[model samples]
Every structure is written in structure tokens, then in C-alpha cells.
Target chain A: MIRRDLVFEIGRTLIAIALALLLGFVIVLLVSEEPFNAFINFVAGPLTTTRRIGNWIEATIPLIFTGLAVCIAFQAGQFNIGAEGQLFFGAVTATIVALTFQLPMYLHVLVALLGAMVGGAIAGAIPGIMKARWGANELVSSLMLNYVFYRLGLYLINYHYRDSSAGAMVSYRLPETSWLQQFWPPTRVHWGLWVALAAILFSYLFLYRTRWGYALRMTGLNKDFAAYAGISVSAVIIYSQVISGAIAGLAGAADVLGLYRRFQWQQLPGYGFDGIIIAILARNHPLGVPIAALFLAYVRSGASIMSRMSDVSAEMVAIIQGIMILLVTAQAFLAKWRHRSVVREAKKHGLNA
Target chain B: MGSTLKGIFSVGFGYSMLRVTTPILFAALGAVVSEKAGAVNIGLEGLMLISGVTGVIVSAWTQSAWLGLLAGLVLAVLFALFMGYFHIKLGTDMVLAGIAMNVIASGGTVFALFVASGDRGISSSLASKVLPTVELPLINKIPVIGPILSGHNVLTYFALLAVVGVWYFLYRTPLGLRLRAVGESPDSADSVGISVSKMRFLALGISGFLAGFGGCHLSMGYVSWFSRDMTAGRGFIGLAASALGGVHPIGTAIASLFFGFADALSNYMQSLSIPSEFVQMIPYLATVAALGVFARRQMSRERKGKKQAGREVA
Candidate 1:
């Protein structure tokens, strides 16, 4: 019965996704003069070359980490909108440590990654502690921290770790010793892809297989009940937040060490917000996070390639993502549509299951 | 000592502070109202961003500042209504709806700019129409208070007036009482014949209106043009101000003013050979510190109340 129910849910989800894509195509058609070309580019643009596939993987790495971050927190019943901030904090820490220290290549990379994790954990813990101890709303706290982290990161890049030769808000270059090895020559893709996959696998095991994961899930589902059952709800919430922050921090580290030679301060990247959409689309499930992340990355990569090849702006990708999130989270509307469709099909068949 | 005092008095920090505070005060007033009605309006950031863009676009197109302000408000209210339909009617999660609205506004505005002007952001053809500053002629003759209050943007005065207006509406009116009751306990309010959804929707609409106006002030009153993400994190700062102020209109206004002072001081200090990046960090760091203080105080108060109750029981 459980397996049947799972299959039914997955089938319904796929149908909803297809309907959403059809609606999005209609929107694109209405908005664009070259509708046919735009639609074709959106569908087949990223699959045209190996470089584009590499770009898709590159985009998916950070998203997978950030999406998993959001998933862990959401599964523990904590809203962590500060993953962007955590990302910045982690990047800054990784860059500083990578620049300041001298070590062998493998050890240097490991230490920098660890530094990022620590930075993210600290940034993420603030909201968790605030929510758990003082009843401060995590949503507001996390959002506020994003600005704090942005400014702090910018300050570090401009004043403390600035490379004057660059003539922009960029930090000193990490020695090649600290950089991640490229998995494929001539492409920016690196070992970070494997790390992201490992993270997703561990997240799934931690959330579903372990005792601590079970406790966290229970707390997320019903905090009062979990408390009554002698679970430390507060502890679980805090732990999940810290872990989520660490993952986001790792993403920041990967972006800097794997792709860029220097640590440049991005004004804002929307990675954290993208993580929120991914978490929502995944329904906060650990196993669903990578799938959602990959889907988003594919759209982003395709949009970039399409923009280069056609007149359609890359900004349309954001519009499609917004629509997807809007449709996915409005589960009641999807449920109603599913119910109507199922009934209509049954009537046509002249049978009820 | 006399020279230092004179220098302090001569510096226009007080005026600059008011200018800085206006946007945040308006946005916080909007947030307080929406949150009180049990709606988490995270889309305030998006609303402000779109309004900021619309205000600049309309003003530049029409050569009238008032038209810009009107356009911003109308657009914000429309978005709010759309969000209300999704959250209240369609039973969508408020936060998710808010996130969707933000994503659309941010990316949509950029795409519209690209299509219309061939530029990625801000219009090139039209010169932005900035709102005229108002100088209180006779009132300026008065001593200390006049200088502080007069010769400001017209919207700044309105923002101050809104603090009192919001306070009265939230505390003194019967509608206010009903709205509060609904926010505190929706089921009880529903049982008592109050339309919880209606009240919540109204609150969100009002919030959108105020947030939109706040965005107008950013473009028309302060910067005189819209840049990409011009509202920056002011919307989030306003939300923090509301929380730190205990969700009271007057308290929120005061908190916003304090933040504004910090912001203005930071800007001023940046000209004095201070690192620009570090100076920019001041307001954000201050916000985190202030919020930390506010949270701790609330925690202590709750503990005190519990202790008193325990002693009474014993």
C-alpha cells in the first residue's frame, strides 16, 4: 500500500510539472516575438555541447550544497533563509585561510574547506539560538543576517585581504596548492561535483537512517509531541541549522577554490534564494534536494546558452523558476486538479478503482 | 568645549538622519501591520524593489514626481492583492508566495529594462523627476525644533505623521481590536463572527501600500533615480526594526530613526578617510547588535515574569 501511494504521488507530481512547463511555454510565446526559436533554444540549447554540460555541472554543485542546507534546516522545522549570508561568510573565511597559510596541496584544500564550514556554522547558529532561546522569529533573523554577512564579506575583501593589483573588490589569490583539482581538462568542472553528490548521499542517510535524523524529523513534524516523547527539540533545531550552514559554507568554498583564482566579493548571487525554491520543490526531503538542484541548474545553463545563441534574454529563466515555485508550493491547487483529472479518467473508463 | 559644541550643532547630522530614516520607517510600519494580522510578508523587499523601479520609470516618463509616487503605490497594491489571492483564496503558503513574488519582480524588472531600453538596468531616455524638498518658511524662524523639523522632503513629514496614525489605528479603533484578536487567535475570532481572512488581507494590502510608498521615497525623494536592487536590504532592515521594536508603531519609528542615524553617521565617516567597506558594515553590524540586545532583554523579562509567578504559587 505504501509503495502504491508513493508511486501515485510521484505520478501526480510529474503530471503537475508537465502542466507547469506547458503553461510556461505559453507565457514565453506571448512575451517573445520569436517564440518558436526561443522555445527550441530553451529545450535543446544546453545539450548541444560538452562545455555546456560542464557548465550545468558547475552550476549544480553550489545549488546542491545550498539546497541540501535548506533541506536539513526545513526538515528540522527551522526556516533558514540566511544560507546566502552563510555562503558569504564561508567564502570569506576560506579565502582568507587559503591565502594566509602555507601547506601541502591536499591539506591546504582540506583546511580551507573546514574553515568555510566553521564560518557557515557560526553564521547559521545565530538564528537558531535566537529562535530556540528567545522565541525570535527565524525568518526575520536569518534575512537580517544576510545583509550583515554581505557587508562583512565586502569589508574583508576591500580592506584586509584586498589584492591591490586587481583594482576591484577582490581578495588575494589562493595559491594553486589550495585549489581543487579539475576533474575534466579545459572545463572549470572540478572534484566539487563529487563532494556535492557525497553530501546528498550523506544527507539522505542522516535524515532517514540514523537515530539523530529520526529525532530531527520527529521534531520538525511535531515539536510539542517530540518534546513529550523526550526528544530535545531545541537541540535538534540548533544542530540542523548549524549543519545546514556548514553545507552552504562548503558551497562558497567550492565556488572560490574550484572556479576563481582570486576571492572576489559578489554583491549578491541569489544562490540562497535559489536554495529556498529548491527546498520547497523538494518538499524538504533530502533525497529530493539533488534532483531539484539539478533541474534548476539545467534551466540556468540552458538559459545562458540560449541567450548567447538567440535573442531571448537569460532573465526568462528566472521567470520560469518563479512560476515553477508558485505552482509547486500551491499544492492545494495541484491536488484539486489531480482529483478532477482522476475522476474524469475513471468516468471515461466506466470503472472506479 | 564651546567650539566642539558649536561644531556638533552646525553639522547637519540631524537632517541627514531623518532622510535616512524615512524609507525604513515607512517599510517598518507596513511590516508591523501585516505581521500583526498573521501574514508573513517577506515580499516587502520585492514590493519595494518594483515600486522603486516603477517610481523612477513613471517619473522619468511623465516629468511629474507625483505621478511616479502614484504609480509605485498602485503597482505595489496590485502585487499585494495578487499575493492575497494566492495565500487567502488558493490556500498557498504565505512565505512561498512572497518568495515567488520577489523572484518575479527582481528578474521581471531587469528583463523589462533590457527589452525597453537595450540596457540591462535603469532607463536611458528619460531624465528622472525627483520630488521637490519642502522648506517650512515661517516655521524655520523658531529655535531648535524648527531647524530639525523643517526643510525636509514632503514625504518625510508624512512618514512621521504615519507613525502616529498607525499607532492610533492599531490601538484605539474598534477595527484595530478585532484585527488584533484575529491575529492572536484566528480560530477564536472566526468563532466570534470575525472574518479572519478578510482582516488579514486588508492588513497585507495596507502593508503593500506603505512599502510601495517607501520605495517611492528611495527613488523620488532620496536618490532621484532607480538603480538595480536600489532598495538593497532596507526592506529586511525594516522588518528587523519592527521585530526589535516589539511590533509597536511608535517603537518601530524610534528604532528606524536610530538606525537611520547610524547609517548617516557611517556615510559621513566614510568621507573622513575611513575605509568605505568598513563604514558600510557599521549599520548592519549595529542592527545585529541591537537585535541581540532586544532579544536578550525580552528573554530576561519573560524569565522574571515566570519567577514572580512561581513565587506567588509557592
Candidate 2:
């Protein structure tokens, strides 16, 4: 029965996506010189080249972990939006570790990842603890904290790690040994992709196949009932957010190690917000996160190609995302169709007597 | 240290602080009204961005800053109505819907900018009209305070007026009480024969208009040209200020002014050896700290109230 409901949700989401794309096409027709070419590029340009495909996957790697992060928090009934800032905090510590120490290649990478995860978790725990102890609103607190974290990162890089000759407010180049190795030559797709997949799998197993997972879900579904059933609601809230932050931090560290040579971000990358949408579209199910992340990454990759190859701007994709999120989240939408289907099922089962 | 303090206390610093606070004050006051209507618009950054662009482009084309401001307000109100439709009528989650609108505004504004001016980075090609900076004729002759208060952008005085206006609108009007009731308890508001959705719609409309004014001040008053993400995080900062201010109009003005002071100080310290980045963090740090304290007080107050009630029952 749960499987059937999941299928229904996926079907509904596809319809929403189709409707959004149709709206996007209307805009393309109104604006672009060659609407057909632009639309084709928007849908099909990413997979046409090997490098582009790798870039698309490269873009998807960070989102998978953030999606899982959002999923964990949402499952525990916490709207901790700190994952966006947590990613940056992770990057900061990861960069520091990468540059400060000299070690074996494998050991350096491991230490950096561990440092990033711990940094993110500590930062992420601020809002969680605040909410648990004082009933502070996590949404506002987390949003405010992002700006502070961003400024801290900027200060650290600009002052302590300034490579004065670089002529920008970026850190010094990281050691080559700390880099995540690529599998295929010249294609930039590194081992970080497999690590992200493993994170997704671990998240799925932890959420569905563990006692703590049951407690988390129970807490989300009904806090009062869960508390009555002997669960420590406060502890669960803090614990889930910590785990969420750790996962997001891991993604940030891995992506930076795999893709870039130095820390150059001056602000939040906005992927954490994207993770919220990914989590929602995936129905807050860990197993569904990778597909959602990949789909979003594909849209982004295709949009970039569409903009370069045709007159249409990449924001066409944003229009699709906005319309899809609005329509898919509207609970009253498609209710009549759902009712009709349910009634048909009752008749088919002959339970009306 | 003394020189830094002197620099911060100078009349020029005070003038810049007022100039910087105007936009934040406008948005924070807007948030106060909307939050009192039971929905806090988290997409204020998007609203400000879209309208800031609209305000600039329309002012540029019409050669009238007023028209540009009007266009910006219209776009913002329409967007608010769109949000109300989905959030109120469709039963969508408010946060998700707000987030969607923000993303749309951010992306849509950029796209529109590209189509209108054929530039992704700036609107430097167009000659946009700026809002007039007013010099109080009689008051300009006064001492240091006069210099600090006079010759500000006209919208700064208007923002100050808006505080009184919003206070009147929220506390003195019959509609205000109903809106408050809705925010406090929608069920009770419904029991009293009030239309919750209608009240919310009206509140959001007013909020959008006020927020639009803030966006206009950014493009039309501050610079006369729209750059990409000119609002940056001002909208979010304004929201934070509103939260810290206890969602009251006067309190919101005070909090926004404080943020403006921090922002002005950060800019002032740019010539010094201190990193501007750390100084730039002051407003956000203040927000988190203020909110933390506010939450602690609320918790203690709640406990006290419960204890008093228990004693009465016994």
C-alpha cells in the first residue's frame, strides 16, 4: 500500500513537471528567436558530450548529501535550514586542514573530510540546541546564521590564508596530494560521486532500517504521542540536526576536494535551499533523493547549454522549478481526480454493500 | 580606539546610518504588518529584487522616478496576491510556497533584466532617474544634529513617517484588531464573523507595497541604477530585524536603525587596518544574539504564567 502511494506521488510530480515545462516553453516561444532549438537544448544538451555529462554529474554530487540532510531534519519535524551555512563552514575547516598539515595522500584526504564534518556538525548544532532549549524558531535563526558564517569564512580566507600574489580574496592553492582522484581521464568526474552514492545508501538504511529511525519518524508524525511513548523529543531534534549537518558538511568537503584547488566562495552557494526542494519532491524519502538531485542537476546543466547555444536565458529553468514547486505542494490541487480514482477502486473491490 | 569611536560618532556617520537604515526600515515595517496577518513572507529578498529591477527600468524608460516606484509597487502587490492564492486558497505549505516565490523572483528578475537591457551584470546603459534627496531649508541651519538629519533621501523621512502610519494602521483601526486576532488565533477570528482570508489578503497587499518602497529606495534613491542582486541580503536582514523588534512598528524601526548603524560602521572602517569582513558580520551576529535572548525571555515568561495559573487552581 505504501508502494502504491509512492507511485501515485511520483505520477503527480511528473504531471507538475510537465505543466511547468509547458509554461517554460510558452515563455521561450515569446522571447527566443528559435524556440524549438532552445527547447531542445534545454532538454537534451547535457548528455550530448562526455565532458558535459561529467559536469552535470559533478554538479549533482553536492545536492545528494544536502538532500539527505534536509530529509533527516524534515523527518524529525525540524525545519533547520542551517545546512546551507553548514556546507560553507565545512569547506572552511576542510580547506584549513588541507593546507595546514602535511601527510600521506590518503590520510590527508581523510583528515580533511573528518575536520569538515565535525565543523559543520558543531555549527549546525547551534540552532538545534537553541531550538531545543529555548524554543527559538529554527527557520529565522538558521537564515540569520548563514550570513554570519559567510562573513567568518571571508575573514578567515582573506586574512589568515591570503596568497597575496593571487590578487583575489581566495585561499592559497591546496596540496596536490589532497585532491580526490579522477577515474576517467580529462572528464573531471572524480571518486566523490561514488562517495555521494554511498552516503545516500547509508542514509536510506539508517532512516528505514534502524530503531533510531523509527523514533525519528514517530517524533515527526506526532511529537506529543512520541513523547508519551517514552521518546526524548528534545534529544531527537538535536541529534537529527547534527546528523543532517554532518552529511551536508561531508558533501561540501568532498566537492571542494574533488573539484577545486582552493576555497573561493564568498557566500552561500544556495545548494542547501535546493536541497529543501529536492527533499520535498522526493517525499522526504532518502532513497528518492539521488534521482531528484540528478534531475535538478540535469535541468541546470541543460539550461546553461540552452543559454549558450540559443537566445533563451537559463532562468527558463527557474521558472519551471518555481511553477513545479508551487503546483506540486498545493494540497487542494488534483483532489477531484484523486477522489474519482479512490471511488473507482472501492467499486472494483465491491465494498460498497 | 578613541579615534575609531570618534569616527563612529561623527555627524557624517549619523547621516550615513540614516541613509542606510531607510530600506531596512521600510521592509521591516512591511514584515510587521504581514506577520500580524498570520503569514510571514520569507521571500522578501525576492520581492525586493524583482521590484528593484522593475523600478529602475520603468524609471529609466519613463524618465520619471515616481512612475518607476509605482510600477515596482504594482509588481510586488501582484506577486503577493499570487502567494495569497496558493497559500490561502490551495492549502499549500506557506514556507515552501514562499521559497518557490523567492527563487522565481531571483531568477525571473535576472532573466527580465537580460531581455530588457541585454546585459546580465548591470543597467548602466539606461539613464534612470533618482529619487530626490530633500534638504530641510530651515532645519539645515541648525548644528550637528541638523546636518545629520537634513539632506537625506526623501524616502528616509517617508520611512520615518511610515512607522507612525503603520502604527496607526495596526493599533488604531478596526481592521487592525481583526488582523491581530487572525494572527493570534485564526479559529477565534473566524468565530467572531471575520473573514480570515480577506484580512490576510489586505495585510499582504499593504506589506507588499511597503516592501516595494524599500526596493525603490535601493535602485531609485541609493544609486539610480540597478545592479544584479542590488538588494543582496537586505531583505533577509530586514526580516531578522522585524523578528528582533517583537513585530511592532516602532520596535522594528529601532532595530532597523541599529542594523543601519552597524552597516554604516562597517563601511566607515574600510580605510582602517581591521578587516571589513568581521565588521560586516555585526548585524547578523546581533540578530542571532537578540533572538536568543528574546526566546529565553519568552520561555521564562511562559513558565511564570503557567505557575501563576496553577497556584490559582490550587
Candidate 3:
């Protein structure tokens, strides 16, 4: 059963990816006057330039962070959808630390990033605590909290931290010392890449090797059995949520320190939402997050190039992503392959058919 | 201070609250119906987006707001059908499919906008036909309360009428009973010779129509122009209303009204020294509060039921 399920998942993902790309190509053909050029650019653009590849990696850093966040909560059977808001809070908190105080460069950056994590953790806990205490649905609460976090962050920057000279609702610049050192010279890929890699490794180790991770996974697989075994399911839910929020916070901090000199968001940076797709593609495996994020980042960068080089809108890529997610999750999509794998597995076990 | 209180409690505030509830009520009604059919449609936000822009473009092209509304409703229903196909027939996770649909709506609408109006930000170039407000025939001539209730957008009245329609459909119809049965337990409904998928499809179809109307109300009835992400979080707010109100049409309307009042209050409070963002957080905050209360009540009830069952077993 397990082997069959795994086969179906992989098969479904491949088919979905192929379908999404094919559909994207069809749309490109219909819209862009130079359809062949547009398709070629979309397929091969990011790899053609080292700078573009670096940009893809840079984008992947934050994507993996949020993806890891979602993967943790989702694996624990918690739908903590408030990662988006937690991320916003993270950015806001990071901005405050960057703008408010003075410290040594490394200390300042570390403190600011920690501040982001704390902020995200706090925001993430609101829904978790509610679910633990009152049985309130995390999905609804977290989803609603997103608006609150976004609006509060917007108000904070627009009202208090507004850089008047910027001529837009943006925050004051961070100290130069607090800025992350760019690893890739030509592109903005910074130290966040290393931090993200560490985080992915940490999550994988935490999920597989740790007792708490086993308990969390058991709770997810069977709540009643986990409870009967004396596992505190509520604690697991809350812990996973808190950690998820921290990861989201780290994503926000990376966005501020690595990508932008100041908080310039007029809207929620959609990394948290994108993380949903990434986490699903990862199949709730923490180690799979970076790989999934890398593929998505590649497609995203390709779409950017295609839009810039030809007459296609970058927004069209969203359709591909949407279709990909829908198709990948469709249980009936690769049912035949799943059945065949099950039959093969039974034969290997030498069971009388 | 007294003047401030008076300003906050003015008839204008009440009127704005009603207007604010219009789209929410439509969307919430859809949420209630779909959820009652065992399919929770979280894609209302996306549906609203697609409908809002489609309504605007169609209204602009046809030079008739009514036709535009129709087109929007049709398109919205089509998207809902897509949701049903993916979730019900194709076996996609309902929540995940809904999320994907929202993404599709967010991006697809902008793509369409860029094609039709050559603008990604707003559909301002399209001279879209706006739905007109109508005076309540007899009520407009009445006293103070009458004027407050009268002269609303036609869709506002339709939103109220839809509550009645939803109530009647749920309680009075055999189909509604079957749909509710599916929600209560699909296996039980299937054993009773009811087609669970068909009922879900119909429920989703109805919900799509209502959500589509809600989207139409935003673009045609309220602003006449479609902006990207203009549905904001109202679709989710509608879902919250349904959950908070326990899937009852009247209860959902009341919940929607409370959020609507918050929305209007936020708009009004923007002129004050208080930041509008904090005020904008009210509807979302209210949703959280409502969820907490509902959860508490539900948990207590379950505890009582468990105790009773234990006693009976003993």
C-alpha cells in the first residue's frame, strides 16, 4: 500500500508538471505573436545566464523557508494557514530592529533576524493557542489573521516608518552593517541561502531522528491511536505551529536583509502562499522543500524572462501553477498506475493472487 | 465626545454597513449552502475576483450592467463547476483545489485585464456600466428609518431576497434534505439511494451562482471598475460568517452585517486620527472571536453528549 501510494504521488506530480507546461505553451502560442521564441525563452531562459540562475537560487531561499514552515505544520496535521501573516509580522519586526537600534554588524543582523522569528512565532501562536484551548479551527483563524497582520504592518510602515523621500509608502533604510553579504556577486543571492540550507537540514533531522517528530507524525497519521498511546496531540500541534511560524519569520527576515534595503511592500509578499504549492510538491517532506522550491523558482524565473522578452504576461504562469497543484492533488489522476504498483508489490511479497 | 458618538451612530453609518454587507451576504450564503452539502468551497475569494473583472468587462462591452451581471454570474458558476469537477469528480482535495482556484483567479483575472484593457492595475479604461440604485417604491416616502433603508443598489435588495430564497430552499425542498443528508454522512446518504456527488455538484453550482452575483455586485453595483485583488478578503469573511452563524442563512446574514459594520466603520474611521489598518483588522478579528466562541460552545456540547452517552452505557 505504501509503495503504491508513493508511486502514484510521483507519477501524478510528473504528469501534472507536464500538463502545466504544455498548457502554458498553448497559452503562449495563443497570445504572444512570437510564440516559438516565447516558449523557448520560458523553457531555457534562466539556465542561459549565470545571473538568472543566481536570482532563481535567491528566490528559492525564501520559498524553501516558507515551504519548510508549511511542511512542518502540515505533517503534524495542522493547517496553520497564517504563515502569510506571520511572515508579514516577521518583516515588520525585522524592520523595527534594523531601524531602531545600533549594534555590531553581525550582532545587529542576528538580532534583527531573531526579532523577525519572534514576531512570526507570536503571530503564529495566536491561532495555535486558540485551537489548543477552544478547538477553534486553525484554517479560518489563521486565514483571517493574515489580513490583520498585513494591515497592521502596512499601517506601521506607512505611518511611522515612512521614508518621505521615497515618494511611496516605504520604510526608512536599514543600516548598511545589518545588510546580508551577497554570496553571488552579480546576483542578489546572499547569506540567506546558507541559512535556508541549514534550516532545511534541521527540519529533516528534527522530523526523522527526534522523538517529538515521531510523536507528531504518529498524531498526524492517527489522532485516536496517538491519544490512546498517551501523546499530547495538542502540544504537538502547538509546537509544530510555533516552529512553522519561526520558519516563516526567517523567510521574511531573508526578504528584508537579502533582497531589499528597506521594507517596500505595498501588499503581502506572496511567498507564504507560494509555500503552499511548494509544501504540497514536497509531499510534506522537509528535505523535499528546497528541491520543490528550486523547480518552482526556475519556472518563475523563466516566466519572468518570457514576459520581458516576448508579449506574454508573467501572470499567465499562475495558471500553470494552479493547474499543476490541482492535477497533482487529484486522487483519480494516476489511479491505474497506483493499482499496478500495488499488484507488483503483492507479487514481490509472493502472496497468492 | 457626544458628537463623536453621534457621528459613529449616524444613519449614514447604518446605510454604509448595509452596502458593505451586500457582497458578503451573497458570498456567505454560497458558503453556507456548499458547506451544508459536505463540500466547503474556500475558493469564493477567487470566484469573486473572476466575477468582479468579468462583470466589469462584460458590462463595458455590452453597455448594460444587467447583462454584465449575467455574464459574471455565468462565468462564476463555470468556475464553481470547475471546482466541483476537480474536487468531487476528479478527487482533488477540496481545500487545496480551492486554494489553487484562488491563485488561478488572482492571476487569470489580471491576464484577462491586460488583454482587454491593456492595464494590469485597474480596469479604469473600460467605460463599464454601473448598476443603479433604486428608491424603495413605498418605503422612500416614509420617515427617517425609511430613507435609511431606501434608495439602495438593486442588488442589495436582491441580497436580502436571496436570504429568504436560501432559507426556503433549505427547509422546504426535498433536494435540500438530500443535500444536507450527504453533508451529515455521505455513506448514509448513498445507502439511502441518494447520489452524493450529484447533490454536491448542484450545491456547488448554486453556490457558484451566488458567489458570482456577489462578485458582480462589487464591480458593477459598487464601483463599476475592476481592480486586481479588489475582492480583498471578503470572500473568506463570507466563509467565516457561514461558520460563525452555523450555516443558517439568517444567522450568516447577521454575521455578515457585523463584519460589514466593521468595514464601514473602518472607512469612516480612516478620516479620524486612528489608523485605518487597525480598523481594517476588525472583521478578521471578529472572525477569530466568533470562531473561539463557536469552538468553546461546540466542545462543551460534545463533552455533555459524551457524558450522557457514558451514563446510558453504564
Candidate 4:
């Protein structure tokens, strides 16, 4: 029965993806004079070059981190949107360490990332604690905090840490030793990929194998039941956000260290918002996050390529994303079919007389 | 410091506060309607963005500000209905669907802007019409009160009217009562023969309509051109305003005025050698703090009530 349910979930996701793509194509056709060329580029352009594949992987790494972050929070049934703020503060903390500390190579990288995680955890904890302790709406507080932290990060970068000679509002160049070591020679793919993959594994194991994980999932399933079962639901909520924030912080550090030379983000990098879509698409499962991230990254890469080669803008991908999210979360989209399949599987396994 | 204090108390500050509050007040009223119906429209941000851009473009094309306003309102309603269809008819989570709408609006507007004017940032090249300002003859000559009250954008007056209008609609009308009843308890509303979904949809439509005015006010009255992200966080701030007001229409208008005052202060403080970033952070920080305090008070009240109930049962 579990197997059949998994299959149906995957099947529903696939159908949703297909419909999203189809709708994307129709939108392109309406906007682009050379609709065929635009559509083809959107569908096939990402696979056209090694460099593009590298770009796709780089994008996928951050999504993986943020996706895992979102999955953890959602699994605890907390609508904490503080990941964006956490990621921003994390990157700022990472940059501070990268610039100020005089540690040796590996230690410098590790310490910077650790600082970032702490920073993000603090940012995440505020809204989490607020929600748990006072019953404040996590969604509004977190959204408000996103702006506060973003402006604070901008202030830190623009006034305090900016390299005067850089001409733009950005931090001093990160030391080469602090950079994530590139594992791929021909492309800029770095060791952050490995960390992201490990995070995926860690998230899955933690969620399914640990006592805290059981408490969290149980709380998410039913708060009354979890409390009756002697779980501290509020503790789970706070820590779920904290864990998510730490992972999101890791993502910010990795993306900065792996992809850029300095802290130059003027606005929220928006990876945090993208993470919400990935988490939903993955059905809040850590194991499914990377696959969903890859799918999003591929479409994003394709959209960018299409924007360059055709009349269609890269923003077209957002339409696809919006459509995909709406369809996937539509509970009744294939409810009857899913129910019938579950019943059939039960009958076949002699679960029902 | 005295100058700063005087500056804040001056007529210019009051006038600009009303100007700034117009959009947020409209959005807050919109939020009040949807929230009262139990279908909170988190997509006000996207709805405003879509309508703001459309108002600019349509006014430019037709050479009539009213036509542009009408077109924008129509699109806002359609998009609201689209969100409604997903949340109400298709069983999608309202918040998630709203987020999706924001994503689509953010990207789709940029795409459309680029296509229309060959510019992705602003519609400066388009000759969009501005809504007229109303000047009260007698009030215009009334010294200190005159400047603050007289030469104001027409929409500013409308926003003030809308607060009272929304209050009346929610408290005085049968449809409004039904909508509130649905939100209060869908099962009870349904048992009473009220169509929960229909009322919710109507609430969403009213929200869209009010938000449409807010959008038009931004492009036509606040600024003469539509720019990328011109609404900024006004939509979310409006949500905060409505929430801070406990989703009451008159209370929301007052809450919006408070935020608008904060915004005006931020703008004013930039001249005082303060770092604009820190000053700008005030409103957002205040929102979080306000929500925390409000929630804390509400929870204590609920807890006390529960204890009293338990004692009664015992």
C-alpha cells in the first residue's frame, strides 16, 4: 500500500509537471513571434552545452539547501518563511569571517560556514520563538524579518564592509583559500555540491530515524495527538525552524563561496522563495527535494537560455512555476484516481475482505 | 531636534502621510474583506502589481485615466477569481496559491513591460495619464488645515471614504454578514443555507476591487509612471496593517496611518545624516514587535477564558 501510494504521488507530480510545461508552451506561443524557436529553446537549450550543464548544477546546489530547509520547517507544520532572512544574514556572517579571520585554509572555510550557520539559526529562531512562546503568526513575523535583515545586510555591506576601490557596493574579495575548491576542471562546479548532497542524506536520515524527527512529524500530522503522546510540540516547532535556518545558512555560505568572489547581493537572492516551491513539489520530503530542485534548475537554466536566444523573457519560467505549484497542491486534482488505486492495491494484497 | 519635531508636525508631513497611506489603506480594506470571509487574500501584492502596470499601460494607450483604472480593476478581479478558483474550487492551499500568484505577477509584469516599452524597469516612455487632485475652495484657504486637507489626490479622499464604506459593508449589509458568518464558521453558515463558497468568492471579488483602487492610486496619483516593484512591500505592510487592526476596517485605516507615518519619518530622517537603511528598517521591525505583543495579549486572554470554562465545568 505504501509502495502504491508512492507511485501515485510520483505519477501525480509528473502529470502536474507536464501540464505546467504545456501551459508554458502556450504562453510562449502567445508572446513570441517565433514561437517554435522559443519553445524549443526553453525545452532543449539547457542540454546544449557543457557550460550550461555546469550552470544548472551550480543553481541546483543552493536550491537543494533551501529546499531541505523548507522541508524541515514544513514537516513540523510551521509556516516559517524566515529562510530568506536567515540566508541573507548567514551570507553576511560568512563574509565577515571570510574577510576578518586569519585562519588556515580548511579551517577558515569551516569556521566561516559555522559562523554563517549560527547567524542564520539566530535569525530563524526569532520568529520560531515568537510563534512558540507567544502564538504570534510566524508567517507575518518572518516576512517582516526578511526585510529587516535584508536592509541590515545591505547596510553592513554598503557602509562597513564595502571595498572602497570596487566601484560597486560589495565586500572585499574573498580569499582563495576560503573559496569552495572546484572539483570540476572545465567548469566552475565546486565542493559545495558535495555538501549539498550530504545535507540531503542527513535531512532524510534525521527526519525518519531520530526521536526529535518522530516528534516533529507527529506534531505536523496532528498537534493534539503529538501532545497526547508526550511530545513537547513547541520545542519541536522552535528547533525545526532552527534546523531549517542552519541549513539555509549553509546554502547562502556555499553559494557565495562557490559561485562569487565577494558579497554583492543587493536584494534577497530569492533562492529562499524558490525553496518553498521545491519543498511543496517534493511533498515536504527531504529525499525528494534534490530531484525537485534539479527539475526547477533545469527549467530555470532553459528559461535563461531562451531569453538570450528568443523573444521570450526568462521570467516566463515563473509562470510555469506558479502553474506547477497551484496544480501540485490542488488536493482534488487526481483524488478519485489516487483513492481507487489505493483501494485496488489493498484488495490485491488481501488487506480487505 | 526642534526643527525635526516641527517638521513632523507641519502641514507637508500630514499631506504626504495621507498621500502615502492611500495605497496601503486601500489594500488594508481589501484584506479586511477577504479575511472576514475566512479566505485571506495574501495575493494583494501580486494583484496590485498586475493592476498598477496595467493601469499605466492602458491609460497610456487610451489617453483616459478612468479607462485605464477600469481596465486595471477588471484584470484585478479576473486574477482574484483565478486565485479563488484554485483555492475554493480546486482545493489548493490559499497561501500557497497566493504565493504562486505573486511569482507569476512579478515575472509576468516584467515580461509584459519589456514587450510593451522595450524597457524592463520603468514605463517612462509611455505617456500615462495621472488622476486629478481635488481642491476644496473654502478648505484651500484655511491656513494650516488647508494645505493638509485641500489639494490632495482624489484617491486619498476615496481611501478615507473606503474605510467607512468597508465598515458599513461588513456591519450593515446582509451579504457582508453572510460572508462574515461563513468565515466565522463555514459549517454553521452552510447549515443556515448560506453558500459558503459563493460568499467567499464575493469577498475575494470585493478585495480585488479595493486593491485595484490601491494599484491605480500608486501609478496614477502617487507617481505618474509605473516602475518595476513600485508597490514595494506595501502589499505585505497592508496585510500587517489589517492584522494589527484585528481585521477591522476602521482599525485597519488607523493602522495604515501609523505605518504611513513611519514611512514618512524614514523619508524625513534621511536628511538628518542617519543611515537610510537603519531608518528604513523601522517599519518592518515595528511590525514584528507589534505582532508579537498583540499575539501575547490575545493568547493570555484565551488562556484565561479556557481556565474559566474549566472551572465552570468542574
What TM-score number comes out for model 4? 0.96
lDDT for each residue of candidate 1 in B1-314, tens digit (9 for 90 to 100): 45434433653767777988999998999989988888878888889887887887878778889998999899998888888888888777888888888887787667665665556666665477887788898888887767877888898988999899888988999988888888899999999999998998889888999999898899888877676777777887788778768789988998898778767767666655566556566656666666677777888999999999999999
Residue range with the least summed lDDT across 10 consecutive positions in model 1 chain A: A1-10
Which pairs clash inside model 2? Answer: none
Q: After superposition, which runs of candidate 3 have C-alpha atoms over 4 Å from their true positions? A: A1-8, A344-353, B1-3
What is the full ranking by DockQ, best candidate first? Answer: 2, 4, 3, 1
Q: Whose DockQ is higher: candidate 1's or candidate 3's?
A: 3
Q: Model 2 segments beyond 4 Å from truth?
A: A347-353
lDDT of 1 by residue, A1-353 (tens): 45744665666556656776786677677767787888888888877778877888889889999999999998898877999999989999999889989999899999999999999999999989877777766887788788878877887777788888887768888899899878786578997888888889999999999999999999999999999999988789789899999999998998999998678766767789999988977878878888888888888877777677666677767667766776666656657656776788769788643
Native-to-model Cα distance after best TM-score fit, residue A63 in candidate 1, in Å: 0.6
lDDT at B120 for candidate 4? 64
Question: Every prediction's TM-score for the first chain?
Answer: 0.93, 0.97, 0.95, 0.96
The top-ranked prediction according to DockQ is: 2
| Clashing pairs for predicted structure model 1, backbone only | none
lDDT of 1: 0.82
C-alpha RMSD (angstroms) for model 3: 2.0
Q: What are the lDDT figures for the candidates, one per model?
A: 0.82, 0.87, 0.89, 0.89
Fraction of native contacts (fnat) of each candidate: 0.57, 0.78, 0.84, 0.83
TM-score of structure candidate 3:
0.96
What is the per-residue lDDT of model 4 for residues A150-230, given as tens digits with 9 covering 90 to 100?
999888888889999988888999998788888886778998899899999999999999998999999999999999989
